[model samples]
Target: MGVTKPFPASVPLSSRAYIDRMDAGLTSVAGAQEIISMISSRRIVTKLILGHNELSDNGCIVLFKFLGSAIGRKYQITEISLNSNSIGNRGLLAISDYLQGNTVLKELFLQDNNFSEDPEVFITFIRALNASHLEVLSLTTNRNLSDPFAETFLPILETPHLRELHLSAIGLTPQSGSPLVAYISSPRCRLQTLKCNGNSLGFRAVKSIIRAIERHNFSLLTVELHANHLVGPVSSDNTSEEDGDEETGGPASPDAWKASETQIRRVLFRNSHLKRETEKEAIRLFRYARPLLLCSSKHANAPAPSTSTRCTDCSCSEIPSPNAPEPEPDTPASNRPPVEGIFPFHALPTELQLYTLSFLAPSLSPAQRSRIYNFASSPSTLPRLGLCLPSFSSNSRNTCVLDPASMPFGLNANTMSPGGGCAGGKCAGSKNSVLCHKEKQRGEWLAVVGCSAYDPYREGEGEGVGEAGILPETGGAV
Candidate 1:
């Protein structure tokens, strides 16, 4: 009796099918072409995973024709994984044709193929990426990939939509690393994850990469630099020192940097075996480093704490006179002075600070008002405008107060009482020579009325208060 064969299920020609490993056991070109013919006739398969098959140029051409054809476009085939299949220049060239017109495909994995011999093939592939909507591309283990094709890949690397790039084990050196650093540094690049492990990128290249990350204000989440010849984790040290305060909201020192590197989940350097057990140690440090880089609630314009402007206990809040000496740098954390005030004004939100200032401004006397304005006009107050009330004029007849009754603009200097120092360029007709300091300070007499008079973000030193003596009467405000 003859054995009966199992019948194949009927699949609709109009329906989209998902095929995976259809050619795993089929090594013949004819067999691969037969599958492509069935796909073309049926107009099915939204995903095709045909890796590890000996599909050379002829088989690839057959697949590309169907994928690029008008009928193939209707099926919405969005993924194609053809890895380790002996694909070469001819096969890639054929696929490039499909990529030019195809907008539906989102991912392409052509890793471990043989397209590195001719540089033009990679160039052609780069051009194809420009026209395609492919978001993720992996060309791993193409060992011949080097500097000759670096220029060709830069545009693709900087592609705004290409969020993930995998080029591991591609024999890349500083030649390729230089251009890659440029690409990563560019604000145009939207890449969030970069895998360039197992390359020969040296320590200098890693330094360049770190500088780019900071200089460009990178938003990358993960970067793998494992199994490279990188001399050390020097990038972390440098970046930590440069951006430590900003990242950790703390001091700019090595400890803070190490703390930041451990806290922030931004970089990855697991297998950079530079010193003996160094990579392991770095990994261990980051693993145990408590995450302190929490999201801050301060307003965007609020000034961050720095050596010059640290006000831990508000001791630095003594408003400087127009002639006050330059402030000393903040002391070390160990030698920090004890707190004196019940209210931590430095810890308050900028809006709250402004609100408090507004309440305090109305109650101050005319003399006190002038002193506050003098303090607010200093360089330190520019960055913290939310606490400033107004920019008073340098006019000698100015009363500095918002009250209309004592307005000095229309009244003569001799009309006011002596205590008001309106005489001798002093307040309320008073001849208080001690309170009336010289007005030779630069940017000291700005007449603009509102907080928006000068932008703090713009560059300019509005005359520093170096070695100038503070008036005893206005010392508290200054």
Candidate 2:
């Protein structure tokens, strides 16, 4: 027994040497805590890698307490990676407080630490971090969130100079996080990189964010959102009813809202000249003129979806209009998802879509509503946005499938309908007046257009030539 003696590895001299390569295999929060005491004894330890360990808030606190002390001040610890841990809002809250106090520490890696994405945690912590000089914050795999913060971490929005923000796999639906949508539209944010993949930010959010980035002058380059269900995983048979063609690509419903801030950002960014540009600005100004209600809770629960937009088989042949851009291999459809901006469009309740299209009518904002209105209303001056206009499918050139309703501007179905008219203005009388009826009647006019122009998606094929009428509410729930 007297033959051997072991040197304490935690002693500052040896610990400092080992700290440089400190790969402590502390497994759980408990293990991490037990080793904290040993590590705390060292005076010069700077970097710590507790990755692949299950360190929770309690365990991290033990380390944070010491780090927050005079010992922590002595060391210029800059990096911390807490990978593989269930550190939710509570843990993030603790870290946020610690971060506010410790400005020396920069580059915090909270990856795999299940941080609570509640709007409060994000907002409060970010606001509290007014003293934080830290940059490069990563919160991956911490899904559980609601509302605004669920899809996007609002705290990062506050960081004026912070460079990178990674929020991959944060639990959310394509429709979630409108608050952040509003935030991104704000001209104040100064973020460079935003990486959100493996989460459901939806096609609409993706397009909205991208367009906003390009419009707002954010120094951003990378955008990722995959693996999460953007297009509802539906079988050929199990299709959504909203996809039906009843509303002529979903009428512009009352709930439809224009991405006004985004439009304003676009106008501010792009030096517009054409009718489309002026009309776009004018319509956006009209929408923004009316203020929106401030959203409080991040996951403040809202009413569930009353209906969803489903695909309708309208005009399976010929391009709906010449406005849609043809998909090319070299196009952004290359690295970017083809259906990226599509989720919000699909998420558009059938009724909302209709209303959007109606206001999209060839009215005061005809040039602006080109994508939403009757083809005639759209200005010849405004060149088509590649996406808004329909395209012939690659699968079969002769058999063209058009997403004619895929317009950048929103069209609420409620306002666009002509009561019983089809050609952009009010229907004079007989069912012939309604576009729906014309399609059903197989009139020479609709026949001339092949229903592609009137029933772009072919939503009402089965409804049989009924007069233009309000679609009967199909008791569906989201």
Candidate 3:
């Protein structure tokens, strides 16, 4: 049968679509085809939910054919749910083939399905997972998968994009524990959620898992161990360490199990705190960086004056005047090429640039940091207010220029105290002291109130206020 036509225009395009249970007679191959066709037509649909439909292998095969097609490639779907659909290896392999070339899909839910019937199918799926962008996967209650399944799935944990995994009640045994612990302990493991509850894991295996979580798996936030063989009471007569090795389907003692649980929780708490702080820092940095990097729409689209060299609302003037000598034809902002005034530093990924700045800012010297701040700040802030005061020493007549950049607390009346630059009260005692030189000359004040300063020539004192400590060439602007 032919695929169904697209939905009518009367229906608004939505980002998410739900077709649960397939009560609309969409449980067969024709139904799958119709669903795929409808979703493909709506380019805005990013999430597709079709769970509990029992669309077995036949329907799944048909669905995947559309997903792997060129028309499917044009769709923006990033999430797909096929849970409890009675899908088997053939259907899963087909999905795997689609994933090999797909980059948009980040979530796939296939819980309570009939998978692992053929081990090679899972092997191929793992290979496809390595190439895919899928981040969250659910395979819960697929009890057919055994220890070998865990061995084969170890590589999926290494997939950087796969963050959350649900493998609960998959018939895993004690043999699968070593491989899981080893993988979790690896520094490259980035899996954040690992749910393996309802498994047959023993005491030693649980202990190993806890130890690995405590030592290496800081990214993991939720590790469901409920309903697993984890804890059991111990007899007071068996006090030796060997008693813990018996592995009677539970921990050697209830106390030991509680201790392990407590330790894991502490580690997870620390990790959670660190993650929150990191996110807060990232947000703070982005707040500061966004205005400097992004061009406002008003400035981005403003037309340039024919006679003027720049726009008043934009930083286009900051670019070399000669580079844009002629006025170009007007175009939409979206179609325009990148503005020359925008720094290439903004081209880096947002997270990477923010992190780089966070690490780099602390290591920079005060002067270097000031220069960076000036660069990032508005053009009006680039001009520092110069303070010129008459020399207070009896021997000199030149003025002292205080560059706020050199001052520890910045240039202000409070920081211009006698103890700052004047040594031995020479400036306070001299007739030429700021207190006595209250005259104004050519829009310049010879002295500032509430401060007795300006003995910039004292040796071993007022070192930075001397002639040699005047504003550097770069800081001499205004």
Tens digits of lDDT, candidate 3, 358-427: 5533322233222233333322222232232323432122323333444556456345643333332333
Off by over 4 Å in 2: 1-30, 33-43, 117-119, 146-148, 227-478
Give the best candidate by lDDT: 3
Instruction: Please give, for residues 1-478, the per-residue lDDT of candidate 2 as tens digits.
Output: 5867787666553235234312455544566566565566765556676666666777776667666776566777777777776566777777776787566666777776666547677776776555575667777776654345643445255544355677787665545545545555553343445667787654445445555544443334334444433444421321222223222332222222233234434543442222233334434433322121111111224342222232232223233343444344343212334365554432444356435544423222232232222222212212222222122232121121222243125643333422213343233323343234323322222212122111212232311122322222110000
Per-residue lDDT, model 3, residue 259, is 67
Query: In candidate 1, how many clashes are counted?
Result: 18
Best by TM-score: 3
The clash count of every prediction, one per candidate, is: 18, 51, 0
TM-score of each: 0.47, 0.43, 0.55
Query: What do the candidate models score in CA lDDT, each in turn?
Result: 0.52, 0.45, 0.57
The residue-by-residue lDDT of candidate 1 on 43-85, one tens digit each, is: 4578888888888777888778776777667777778888887
lDDT of 1: 0.52
Better of 1 and 2 by lDDT: 1
What TM-score does model 1 achieve against the real structure? 0.47
Candidate number that wins on lDDT, 1 or 3: 3
lDDT, candidate 3, equals 0.57
Where is the poorest 10-residue window by lDDT in model 3?
Answer: 442-451
